[model samples]
Target: MCGGDFMSKNPEEAMDFLSYVADVSRGWDEPTKGEVGKMKSQLNAYNAKAGM
Candidate 1:
């Protein structure tokens, strides 16, 4: 939730934040799969917001 406001206000920042989440999640273990799924949902939200 660190950049919730920034992401909502700035599409570019949202994309960057989501990309970072995706990159970081790539190094996570299986136990963190659920967290990664959450990130995916966030990414989808960002995409929808930015009309990507």
Candidate 2:
């Protein structure tokens, strides 16, 4: 439940680039609005790979 856990990289996981973006135009909620949620999801998906 820490940022470090979310930012950890897995050796077995495929590396992926996460592009940071903001969606604040009202109905952009993919569980939560704004870039915060999206970023978190992306990070989790990518195992928090850097150079994002």
Candidate 3:
């Protein structure tokens, strides 16, 4: 499993990472879809914090 700590690097990096995650999460089950949504929310918060 990959550690989410990598997301703290920078807004651009986080956006790219989340975009990849969104792509990979496509067609996933309901629970996994929920997780992806949570991840997207986190990424949004991070971007906001970074003024992206």
True-vs-predicted CA distance for residue 3, candidate 3, Å:
1.9
Give all candidates' CA lDDT scores: 0.79, 0.50, 0.80
Q: What is the TM-score of each candidate against the true structure?
A: 0.42, 0.27, 0.42
Best by the lDDT measure: 3
Tens digit of per-residue lDDT, candidate 3, span 1-52: 2385875668887788888888878856455777989999999999999999
| Residue pairs clashing, model 3 | none
lDDT of 1 by residue, 1-52 (tens): 4444763557877788788888888877554778889999999999999999
Hey, what RMSD does candidate 2 come out at? 19.9
Q: For model 2, which pairs clash?
A: none
Query: Considering summed lDDT, which 10 consecutive residues are worst modelled in model 1?
Result: 1-10
lDDT against true structure, model 1: 0.79
Error of 2 at 16 (Å): 45
Of candidate 3, the 10-residue stretch with the lowest lDDT total is: 1-10
Q: Which of the two candidates, 2 or 3, achieves a greater lDDT against the reference?
A: 3
RMSD vs true structure, all candidates? 16.7, 19.9, 16.8
**Deviating ranges (above 4 Å) for candidate 2:** 1-33, 48-52
Off by over 4 Å in 1: 1-3, 30-52
